[model samples]
Target: MNKTINQKAWFFVVPVFVLVAFNAVIPLMTVVNYSFQETFGNNVFMWEGTRWFKQILQSERFHAALGRQFLFTGIILVIQIPLGIAIALSMPKEGPWVSVCLVLMSMPLLIPWNVVGAMWNIFALPEIGFLGHTLNGLGFDYNFTQQIGDAWFTTILMDVWHWTSLVVLLSYAGLMSIQPAYYQAAEIDGASRWSVFRYIELPKMKKVLTIAILLRFMDSFMIYTEPFVLTGGGPGNATAFLSIDLVKMALGQFDLGPAAAMSLIYFFIVLLVCWVFYNLMMKNEEQS
Candidate 1:
């Protein structure tokens, strides 16, 4: 017997394919095109080959920005992951308070990114803002605008405030999915709280924790807007992570070739890290 395949479902996918091509593929191709050539006005271009890429890879500024980006992402991950899990553990799992807790947690994630940046910008001014004023009143010497330490602190604090909720939500969902039988078993065995968490909750949460780590890594690695608005990459480029630096090169300095090269590098870095995370998570799943 010969089978004829029905291809009608592809019609539904055609629109989505075309939309992605127009929005993602086409612009990506343009960036690749610009990455190889130098332009000097009136559509004039020179085929510079790998010159831009070499410059970007060798630049000290790029290195500095990359290091800062890694540092920021690392710090936030260390803080947010455990903190989110702790808060989720503390939260009422099944009560009227659950709804109130969830809503409160969601509020930060609902705020627009740019608005969060702008809000934090004023909120950290060290003059009129409540946080700034309170800190200064307590003799903390906090001034984000002109102080590198303060700027970094403020930016990190703002990020933790805005994003910890996401991790909390994910973790709480993971915890709730776990069967109560595990807890009952632990109770019967006279398991300590830490023992329950270690042998049962943590193991069960591994998958979601992996997902949470990946999401947070991607977001923090590509973070740009909030720190930009708050510190403006100031205090001698202290908070100028890779994204901020790339914008400065592309728009601020109008160095298209180098900027494109740097952007492609940035893209590859993010892609590579995500790929590694995926592989590690998959390997762990296989082993378990």
Candidate 2:
């Protein structure tokens, strides 16, 4: 006997497809058009071929910004993932405090990004800001606005403060999903905490951890508003990640072609990293 598949679901999905194409595809095509052409005034555009792409690819400023962007993302992932897991591990598995802890963990994620940046900016000022005042009072020369090291430190610290909660929540959910039978079996076998985690919890949490890493990587890689509001890509271009540099090229200097090309390259880099990392993760899962 042959089975028939219903095609009526297409009627419900067409609107969503059209909406997505309008919102996503049209803008992307606009960017592609802008990337290959130059506009001086009005809506006029002249064909420039691949000159903008080559110029952006060869530019030292682009290289520096790209390096900084990667470095920031690397540092964020390194710190946030382990730290989030540790926090999740230490939390009470069953208690009234669970709700409280979850609420606290979620608070940071709820704050507006620009507000978080401004809050940190004011909070870290050396004169009246509590953090800076305390550090300076402790005999430390800490001025993020004036010093490169301090600026980078503050940027990294701010991101960790803001996004680590996402990792913690994801890890905690993974931990919560492990069956009690696994722990009982581990206990019967005299499995140490490390052994239990290694054999059971770690493996169980692999999917969530993969999700957490990918999310953090993409967010950190594309970060702009917070750091731009916080440091304004300042301390002499030290914190000027790719997003900030792209904005500078497009709006600050009115270089639309190069900016559009850079944006596409930026999009490709994110896509490539996510693709490679996700494939490697899936490959490991399949092997195990």
Candidate 3:
């Protein structure tokens, strides 16, 4: 006899569906509506088709912002992934210190993003800031506010400080999930640390690492508040990522149509990249 499925669970899911519709779907639909329409003022809208999309796509400013966004994400991924793995590996597997280490690692992640930016901004100022004063005292011109290179450096450093902990935590969790049998076998085979990690730990951690990478990629790509607080897209648009540009267009310039179009494009690019990453990761897992 076939077992009957419980239909009562459907009621529980309805609330979640409604919540998602209100939070994500509704906002997305609004953006989509704005993207394809033009408004002069006072809630008046006229169908503009794909005019805004084409304009945003063709604009050199959008292109530059997109390039910078990609570059920033790439740099963070490169720095954080390896650094996190190394830190996780070095931590104690079983000890009183494990709790201490974990808490320390989590401290940065607990701070508000805007606060992190503001703190870093103050900490890196050329005159009164500790970092800036020390660097300048050492005869180096370290002014993030006025210098493009210094601004990029400070932003990257701040992100690494704030987010690398997340990678470390994920990597540690992945490491913790490994069965003792695997280590036993590796030890019995006289396997080196590199060999053990390469053959065992790394493969096991792939799933979590994929998650870590995706989270970091999305966060870094969509980053706004911190960079906005710190740089204000200053030194002449040097640090202005897509999100900042979109905000500037929508609010600063009051160009809602183009901004909405750009936001939709931005949303899709993130979605597409994430889809590709998930596919590639799953494919690798299947092959392995």
Candidate 4:
């Protein structure tokens, strides 16, 4: 005889569905509406079809911002992933220091995003900030406020400092979950440090590393507040990524139509990249 399913379980899911609709679906629908129409105060709208999308896709400003956004994401991924893994590898496996190291690793991740930005802003001021003053005193011309290279370097350094902890924590967790038998077997085989890491730890950490990379990629791509606070997208728009440019268009200049279109495009690009990353990483897991 077939067992009957409990219909009551469906009732429990209603709240989550309602919450998601209220938070995500409704706002997305509003954006979709604005993307195809133009408004001039008083809720009045005129159908503009795909004019805004066409314009945003054709604009050099959008292209430049997109390039900068991609570059930032690429740079962060290159730095954070390997550094995080190396740090995780170096941490004590069993000791009081484990707790202390974990706590220290977690501190950066706990800070608020806006506060992190503000802290970096003050910390990087050329004359008064500790980092800026030290660099300048060392005979290096380090002025993030006025130089494009300095702005990029400071921004990347701030991001790596804040987010690398997340990767380390995740990697450490992945490392801890491996069975001792794996290491015992590797030892019996006389595997070197690099060999054990290559054959055992790396494979085991694949899923967590995939997750870390995706998280870093998405966060880096969508980053705005920190860079905005630190640089104000200045030094002649050197650091104005897609999100900053979108805000500038939508609110700064009140060009809502193009902004909405660009946002949708930006959303799709992120979704596509994340999908590809997840699939490729998962495929490697299957092959291994």
- Root-mean-square deviation per candidate: 1.5, 1.9, 1.9, 1.6
Candidate 2: segments with Cα more than 4 A from true spot:
1-9, 280-288
Model 3: per-residue lDDT, tens digit, 1-288?
999999998999999999999999999999999999998779999999999999999999999999999999999999999999999999999989999999999999999999999999999999999988899999999999999999999999999999999999999999999999999999999999999999999999998999999999999999999999999987799999999999999999988899999999999999999899999789878976
Best by TM-score: 1
Candidate 3 local distance difference test against the native? 0.95
The lDDT for every candidate, in the order shown, is 0.93, 0.94, 0.95, 0.95
How many steric clashes between backbone atoms does each model show? 0, 0, 0, 0
Q: Give every collision pair in model 4.
A: none
User: Model 2, 217-260: lDDT tens per residue?
Assistant: 99999999999999999998999999999999999998999999
* TM-scores for every predicted model: 0.96, 0.94, 0.93, 0.95
Sequence-dependent TM-score of model 1: 0.96
Off by over 4 Å in 1: 1-4, 284-288
Judged by lDDT relative to the true structure, which candidate is superior, 1 or 2?
2
The lDDT leader among the candidates is 3
Instruction: List where candidate 3 sits over 4 angstroms from the true fold.
Output: 1-9, 284-288
The alpha-carbon lDDT assigned to residue 180 of candidate 2 equals 98
Error of 4 at 284 (Å): 5.5
Candidate scoring better on TM-score of 3 and 4: 4
Clashing residue pairs, backbone N/CA/C < 3 A, model 1:
none
Lowest lDDT sum, 10 consecutive residues, model 1, at 37-46
